[model samples]
Every structure is written in C-alpha cells, then in structure tokens.
Target: MQTLEKPKPKYTGKRHRLSKPELLAPAGNLEKLKFAIHYGADAVYIGGQHYGLRSNADNFSFEEMREGVEFAKKYGAKVFVATNIYAHNEDIEGIEDYLRNLEEVGISAIIVADPIIIETAKRVAPKLEVHLSTQQSTVNWQAVKFWKEEGLPRVVLGRETSLEEIAEIKKHVDIEIETFIHGAMCSSYSGRCVLSNHFTDRDSNRGGCCQSCRWKYDLFEDARPAEAWISEEEARESSVLKNFKLGVTQLPLFNEDDNAFSMSSKDLCMLESIPELIEVGIDSFKIEGRMKSIHYVATVVNVYRQAIDSYMADPENYVLKPEWIEEINKAANRPLNTGFFFNTPDHEDHIYEPEEKAVPYDFAGLVLEYDEETGTAVIQQRNYFKPGQEIEFFGPDGTFFKQTVGQIWDEDGNELDAARHPLQRIRMKVDKPVRYFDMMRKRK
Candidate 1:
C-alpha cells in the first residue's frame, strides 16, 4: 500500500554506514549457487535432496552440497541449507540424519520451520547454526525472543512484518534478522495454505505444492455448476460459454479462463526501499526464488548487490538508479509491488488479472570461454538469436555493452546463420572480452 516514489537524493559528501546486511540469494542447485555468490550475494540458501520446501526444484545432492559449500567459501561467502519443510509424522524418520549430513557437508546454517528438525539439529549437530524460517510467521518481538532463547541465532521475519515491526524486533532481540527483499510471494500468510491437498493428493507443507490456488474453477452452488455468469438475455447474445475466454497467449499452469483470479500475489521488489530497509537494522536481505533460472538469479542478485553497495558506499549521496528497476523487470513476469512493508496489501497488490505478461528481453547465451586475443566468446545458447540482432552482455560485475551478433560458428566450426538450437555451443565475437559465467540477453 506504500507509494514507491523514489527518495530525493541529497549529497553532503559525508558517507556513513550503520551495518552492512548480508545479501542472501536463493539457489535451486550448485550452478545457480555459484552464480549467486559470484554476483555479490553474501550468502546463498539452497535445498538439499531432502527435507527442503522446494521439493520439486532441482535440489542438491550431498556431494553437490559439499561442492557448493567449497565454491561459496572461495568468495568468502556462506551457504545455508533450507530444511524448512514442516515434517509430517511419517516424514520425521530420518530427519536427524539429514541434519547431520548437512552439517557434514559444511553448511553454515539451516533454515528450519519444524520444531523436530530444529531440536534434532541442536542436539545432534551441536556445531551447526539454526535460523528460524519465515514459515513460522514470527512478526512480534516476543516471538523472536522465544526463538533466540531456544538457541536459534537468526529469525527470518514473516513477509507480513513491516519496517516499523522489524526495527522494534531488533530492539528486543539480539539475534540476526532476515527479510525477503525481492521475488514471488505466497498467497497464504507464511505459506500455510492447504489448497493443494484439497485439489490434489500432494501435501503443500512438505514440498509437494501443486499451486492449485493459481488454477481457475467454475462457480458452483447447491450441488450444481453455474453455467452462466450473466443474465439469460446477456448470455443469449453471446455464443461463447459464459461469454468468457481464457486470457493467455500460452498456458503454463491452469486452464482456467480466470488466470488473474488465483491467490498468487504480485511480486515484491524493494529497489526503492533499500535505504529504509537498511535503516531498520536488518541483518540479512533475502531473495525468494529457489525455482527460478540462472538468468533470474543473476539479474536480481546483481541489481540488489549494486543497490546495496551504492548506498553503503555513500549513504548521504545514495540515489536510486532507474536502470536497477529496469534490470529487475527483465527477470520478473509478474507486476512488482512492495508487499506488507508500508501497510497491509490492499486489493491493488493482488494479481487479479491474467498474468504472464511479455517483457522486452530474453536470456540468449552464457559465456563459456573467452578469447582475449580475438575478443571472441565461446557461448552456450539458451534461446534463439540470429545475426544482426543486438545482444547485451553482462557478467558478475559487467554493467552492460551492446554487441551485434554478426557471425556465429558452431562447436565443430560449422557456420550458422542463427543460434536456434537449445544448449548448442557457438563461438561468437563480442565488442569486449567476457568471463566464464557472463551471459548475453537480447530484445524479444
């Protein structure tokens, strides 16, 4: 409900900092974990092969967790595992071992919502740190105090907590506090919805959510489906069923003509509120897309990373860059709003219309190897792009530069007019040298 007006910049040339909060990002797997850290995330939260909320995501194996931990340590970054799923009676059998295995993999901490997982980790793995997950919905300072007394060193405050609440929580508890700064939001408070279990056999809490809330349904009453949404005379004037049509160019989830009627809310983007967020004494700033792509992770993390750095470098001179908002939009499909930060979200915050809106750009390629001598890059194609199309190249720290895709050669030296095949390797010339993991994007 808060206005996202840009704060006026006032420069007095005096730079100061309160605290440098950790820039935490989410990673579904090891490659994304590496990208998050390289792109300036101070810490990255990932799900293991078990007990994580994103069960459908490409979670990491123990071996992969170890490798990811080692990779994160290289950049002085930390790795946290998400053991945040609320375990059922049947799901509790081997959770202790999962906790121990995570500690063995050198995870810095585990974000947990279940009491069983938290107490077991505290008892068995005495060295592993535990943070309370946002699923617990700890909005009050008293809840934070209780968790801190229980030996939980950090608490990710619920998305419903406001800036006023976060500052108050810091006053009462000495524990580290984290808040979601960017990404998709759950329709339910703290994600306690069970609509998936009602619609399908899957459990929503234990990581098998089918997102049934995003589906469309026919109106029913008194054991009979309503065939019309309007008067009989109005219905007679139109041949289409209920005079309704599904408003999507392509279907990603449900077949409901009501794509926007789902409980899925607009995404949360705090680019304009970075200064206020920092002023609230938040210990960590978190991003919420474990199921998102490498491009999304890179773009979001890079924007937040730059925003935080610019403000921290010169708080008095800090000004929100218009380009930062533009960069974040490239990765977001849903409209952005400040969720529950200023005031309780009203009707305007809900995604009440058809979603899947078009953006201006697409991730075209990822730089694999760069030839410094010739200013050429060996790239793996992720999307279609042809010669003469303008592409933007960015890296962990690359601002951006435009390069026309003039010529491309395939892996075997065969020339190609366009890089159309998925994951196909190609050698292309760039305007400047790039590094491994740097990526390319083009207008769609």
Candidate 2:
C-alpha cells in the first residue's frame, strides 16, 4: 500500500502594522489590581482614598497604592490613579499634597477632571503624565486640542462620541485619545448631570451620585389650566387628592401599570467592533467597573486581552471567538449594546424592562495549590460547591477544561459534604491537573 503525502498547515501573514492599544482595566482594591495585571491588563486605573469616583469602593490607602504600583511594575504594567472628582473649595484643599504623595509613590499617571487639580498636578509633579478624565466632557476635536494645549498627555473622550468623531479628534489633537470600550454607561451627557444632587443631595460630580437616573419615575401632568402650578412640596402633599380636584391628566409618559427602566442605558460591549476600534486609532481601551468583583475584572481583562492578542498576532485571519462573548456574559452585566460607536444609540439601546442577563456559570472555587503525589488540589471556596458536581477550570495560560469534583477534605482532614463557606479551604482529588490561581466555575 502507498502512503498518502502529509498535508501542511496553512500559513497566514500579518495584515496590518497597527500597534495594540493599551488594555485598561479597573482596580477596586489590591486583589483586583493584581488580578487585572495577571489576566493581561496593560495598565490598571484605581481610585485613591479620596477625590476619585466610586466612593463606595475600597479605594487604596497611600501605602496600598505604593504597594500596588510596585506589584504592577513587576508585570511590566502601569497604574493610573483616579483624582477625577469635580472639586469644591473644600475638595481643592490639600490636593497639592496628595499629588506630591502620588508622585512619590511612583504612580504612572493621574486622571483629573478639574482644571485646578490639573494645574496643581503640573505644579507639584511635572514629571507625571496627566490624563484628562471622562468627566471633562471632551466631545469635540476643538475641546481635545484645547486640552492638548493645556499640556495634558491624554484625554478620555466622552462616551457620546461616535467612531467618526473620535477619528476626527485624533487627527486634530497630538495627545492620546482614550475611550471607554466596555462597562456601564451614564444616562447623562458625559456624566455631567445634577439629577443625583437634585434628588438625593448627593453630588454626582463629587463622587456621591445615588444613581437617581436609574430609579423609576412617575410622570404626572397637571390638567388645571396652568393655574395649579404648585411647589414640589405642595404637589407631593396633595398627591392623594382626586384627579378632578388635582387636575391630573390621564396619560402617563410610560405605562402606569409597568415600572419602566426608561433611563437605564445598556452596558457597552465593543468586542465585535474591536477591528473597527483599532482602525479608528483609539489609543486606549478602558473597562469601567471599579466596584465590580475580582471575577469580573479577571474575566473581562482576559477576554479583551485575548481579542487584542489574536488580532495583533494575525490580523488577516482574526475572527471574534464565540467563547470570548460567552466568558464576558458569565460576569455580572447588564444587557449589552455598542454605545455610540456605530451610530447614536436611540430608544433601542435603553432597556425599558430592565432585567439582568443570567450567567451560564457560577464562580465556585479557586485553586490554591496542587499536590502531585496525591492528585489533590487545594482550593478556596468562593461560592458553594459540592462533590459530584462538574466544574470548569480556566487559568492564566487560557486553558479551559471541565472535570467532576471528587472526594473533598477540609484543612484538618475532615471530610466535608460541600465547601459552602466563603474563603473556606478544602482539598479535593482531581483527575485533570490544575495549577495555582486556576478558577473553577460550575455550570448553572
């Protein structure tokens, strides 16, 4: 019998000479910061103890920020500190000292919205790069040019900007243009709205937003011939009055029976448009979610890193992987849409009946160590996991595989039915091998 000739693998060459844009991820705390870097973030943006948005997040203390910077440097990544709050007179006080401290701690850059803070940073740490924050409402090319003239090294453009507008702005400005590629979007224009302050006395600009825009509203019309104009307090007091006496119109802006989430915009997902984004010359791709979980940070950063790497490796044969989208959806997220990238998003982009998309998997545990001799993996429980349940493992090397949980034992060698407690350490026999820091997720 004659042997058939072996077939050779097809070769595809590079399609473009484009440089990969920085994959910028959010770091709510030290753990998330490390995960972001390990999962392949080129840089991580974090909030300091004061002046940054996401006031509820565990913003880094000065010492933590110092340590975070050193940790990032070990992986050849940078740390950008957020000082982007719109400052009041009280907020401006001691800002210079804060900038000096940041510079001393070896921060890669400072994100600033207030002109005063920018001027202060320039004066205090002239060597540090200043990134104009998205809170600056940088939409037009003229505004970008103005910011460039003011000596900012980069300007994060408003989310309202279209791809064409971004390309135009890039042409007019010499500085870098960073745009938010993923995460939750603000209802207001470039997040410059007073609804939070108006409703709850929590200043959105000062990082005290209550997200009042996302709340349900009842729109009532006064039928009393324009003479029934009353103070908001008086109207509230008289809200119980009959429709005839109150001159209340019958029609509602939304269906009265339904509580519509009219103002809630869907979370941005630019995975499918990565090629277009690259073609437009965007300098940095930002992921928003400082208050998000560590799993979110790891998953999002990992997927985006894969997309960027895949495209960079062979742009000619680059294809958006279905698994990337599946992985991103596994994280807690709103309904996904491409926000203002292809065109201006209209009513279709807003979820009238807001419902979170269910994730296909649940974070079950994390691999702490593996004992080769016993074929047992030491793990820490993140969520409840029991023996006989199937789990999927994903690691830094991008390997993913499924295996069934076997016999489990606690640290003291006591057998446990389930690893139910958060951060509870357990040991389990595994047929498939896993390394340290590997994550296990159970199918829902």
> lDDT value for candidate 1?
0.85
Residue 118 displacement (Å), model 1: 0.9
lDDT of 2: 0.85
lDDT of 1 by residue, 38-76 (tens): 899999999988888888898999999999999999999
As a whole number from 0 to 100, the lDDT of residue 150 in candidate 1 is: 95
Residue 32 displacement (Å), model 1: 1.2
Cα lDDT of model 2 by residue, 17-67, tens digit: 476899999999998999899889999999998889888899998899999
Candidate 2: stretches off by over 4 Å: 1-16, 226-250, 259-261, 357-361, 372-374
- Root-mean-square deviation of Cα positions for candidate 2 versus the true structure, in angstroms: 6.0
- Model 1 misplaced stretches (Cα beyond 4 Å): 1-17, 217-260, 358-360
Ten residues in a row with the worst lDDT in model 1?
242-251
Query: What RMSD value applies to candidate 1?
Result: 8.6
Worst 10 residues of 2 by lDDT: 7-16
